[model samples]
Target: MTLAVLSGVGVLAFAGFVYSGVYDVGADNAHTRPVLSLLQTMRERSIASRAEKLTLPPLHDPARIRQGAGNYNAMCTGCHLAPGVAETELSKGLYPTPPNLTREQVDPREAFWAIKHGIKASGMPAWGKSMKDDYIWNMVAFLQQLPSLDAAKYHEMVEKSGGHSHGGGESGAGHHHGGEPMEHDDADHADEAQEHSEHTEPASPSTVPEHGKPGHHH
Candidate 1:
């Protein structure tokens, strides 16, 4: 009987605390110390528990890491940042700031899970819906090696990767394509049509190279 009474009282007190309107929800200020600690503990524990059962892939492949570098720049750099990036507009505004991946050492499987399935209530977006698994893995692979690179090396790889500014392909399937999809398709079709036309045409005397072009001189 005593235990039941105590439980009822405790429940009421907890309910009163919640309904009291003393808790601040604004992002401008940090969470109260105890609440902050509680949240951190819960998030860490959950991630660790889930990661234990995961079998991680070999994340050291150069090709995948290069792919991941491009994806990260397109998708993640605004929040997590790359080497030599001092700050980002989002980094300042997010309440629990996103870590600078360039400086932070991330566990591969945990990073994969977080990238594929974003943390709840955090600013991170889930990439799995739009990206293929291979792409997600590539992002993880890039992150594993991010700490060692400088800004120049990071830029060089991303520039060469030819990934979408916002997502997977030139179509930018993961983000808005802004007419580029049809444009690209039309361009490809035009090239095909031109090739067909060229093959069927009789070569005009003036159009024939006659082996007189500079490279053809040999």
Candidate 2:
């Protein structure tokens, strides 16, 4: 009788998970704790499983780091926020707010794969489809060293690599107001700082919105 009751419970729970429309697909809705935890676990496990067999070529050239920094600054820094760099107003309001790459949790291969293929349902998009293989690999090489880098180093690398980022919406690709760039009235990096505390999550090491157009820079 007890076995039968447990089986019934399992069936009902599975059915509930499948039939329930409670899962919010919107970019606006913050994930519930259980849902967020599931996603996080899935992300870690999937990366670990897949990255194990992937062999990475030696990528120690300083030029590669410079090149990757260019891509990161112009494309990723606004959302991901480089070491010691601050966030923008647009990045602040985003649900799941972008991750800080300098934190201890990020792994090298995971960073590479995340850049190349991008994450699904979150804002990360696959750069492999849009960017060339060499560029993607360069970014990977740079990410391997991101944790040890300080804010000054981050700025220097990007600037040396030819990534001169201007404030305002000009640097990014996607837009809510049609294809045209959306205008934010308060345009300083200081204004960008305002959105930091608004974030709902404690923010894991590195994150991008499931939808905010990760990887591909305009």
Highest-TM-score candidate: 1
lDDT at 45 for candidate 2?
91
lDDT of 2 at 10: 97
| Residue range 116-179, candidate 1, lDDT tens digits | 7789888888777777777788888888888988867876666555443224222222221111
Model 2 spans > 4 angstroms off: 1-29, 164-218
Cα RMSD (angstroms) for every candidate in the order listed: 13.8, 11.3
TM-score, every prediction: 0.74, 0.63
Tell me the deviation in Å of residue 56 in model 2: 1.8
Supply candidate 1's per-residue lDDT for 211. Answer: 16
Candidate 2 has which clashing residue pairs, if any? 99-207, 122-210, 122-211, 123-209, 123-210, 123-211, 123-212
Which pairs in model 1 have colliding backbones?
none
Candidate 2 local lDDT, 26-111, one digit each (tens): 77778888989999999889978887766776678888776766666556655676676466544676667777676655666776
User: Which regions of candidate 1 deviate over 4 angstroms?
Assistant: 165-218
